[model samples]
Target: EPEVTQTPSHQVTQMGQEVILRCVPISNHLYFYWYRQILGQKVEFLVSFYNNEISEKSEIFDDQFSVERPDGSNFTLKIRSTKLEDSAMYFCASSRTGRTGELFFGEGSRLTVL
Candidate 1:
C-alpha cells in the first residue's frame, strides 16, 4: 500500500535546541496532522493542516511547535526550542476527509532530550 514516510527514526537533542522532523505523506491525502506519544503515554493530537493553512490545532500545539508543508509531498514539524518534555515519539498522519476518517500514520520520529 502507499504510505507516509518519516526520517531519522531517532534523534537526541539538548534541553533547548531547534529540531525538525520530516515526513512525506501519502500522495492522494488531503489532510495532514501531527500527533505525539510520550513513551508509555497515549497518543495526543497536536495539529492539522489542509489547503496550505492550519485547519485545527490542539492546545498542546503551543508556541513551541510549528508545522509546514514545504512541498507537495513533504510535511514537517519544527520545534523552535526543544525541552526535556519534548522527548517523545512524533507521528505524522494523513487522511482524506470526514470526522470518521481513518488516519494513516508513519512509524514515528523518536525524540530524546538530554
Candidate 2:
C-alpha cells in the first residue's frame, strides 16, 4: 500500500530559528496538503499544493511559511522563523483526488520551539 512519509518525526528548535519539515506523498497521489495542530488546539489547514503551485492556503500560512516540491517526489514546508506559538504536530496528507476524496496522512512531525 502507498503511504506518506515524513522525516525527523520530532524537531526541537529555538524561537527565531528556521525549520524545514519534509514529506513524501504517495507516488500516484495528486493533491498534497500540510496541516498542523497546536498542543491542545484543533487541527488547522496550512496549505495545499498541486500541479506545482499552491492551490489553497489558510491565514496561518503567512509570509514566514513556504512550501515546495523540490524533486517531484518530496514535498517540503519551510518556516523562515520559528515562534513558540508555532510548536505543533504538522501533518502531511495526499489524496487521489481533491478535497472530495479520501486522504492518507503521514504519522506527523512534531515541532517544539523554545
Candidate 3:
C-alpha cells in the first residue's frame, strides 16, 4: 500500500518569511494538488498540477505562492512571503485520474506564522 509523504510535519516561521512544503506521492499516481485548511476554517483548494503544468488554481494561489516538481518524485509548494493568515495545515494529494477520481492525501504539513 502506497501513501503520500510530507516532510517537516510542523513548521514555524516569521510573518514575512518564506516556506516550502514538500510532498512525495505514490509512484504511479498522476494528478497532484495542494490544499489547505486554516485553523477553524474549511479545507480549500489551492492548486492542481499535471503533466508538469498547472491544471487549476484557486484565488488563494496568488503572487506569493508557487509550486514546482523539481524532481519527478517530489512536489513542492513555496510561499514567498508568509502572513499570519497563511498559517494552516497544507495537504498534498494525488489521484490516478484527474477530477472524478479518488484523491489520496498526505498527513499534512502544518505551517505556523507568527
Q: For model 2, what is the alpha-carbon lDDT of residue 14?
A: 94
Give candidate 3 regions above 4 Å deviation: none
The order by descending lDDT is 3, 2, 1
Cα distance off (Å), candidate 2, residue 78? 0.3
Model 3: residue 106 alpha-carbon error in angstroms: 0.3
TM-score of each: 0.96, 0.96, 0.97
The top-ranked prediction according to TM-score is 3
Question: Worst ten-residue run, lDDT, model 1?
Answer: 93-102
Residue range 62-112, candidate 2, lDDT tens digits: 999999999979999999889999999999999888855588899999999
* Candidate 3: pairs in clash: none
lDDT against the true structure, each candidate: 0.93, 0.94, 0.95
Listed per model in order, the count of residue pairs whose N, CA or C atoms clash below 3 Å is 0, 0, 0
Summarize candidate 3's per-residue lDDT along 1-114 as a digit string, tens digits: 899999879999999999999999889988999999998889999999999999999999999999999998999999998999999999999998886659999999999999
Q: What is candidate 1's lDDT per residue for 13-111, written digit by digit as tens?
A: 998899999999999988999999999999999999999898999999999999999988999999978999999999999998736469999999999
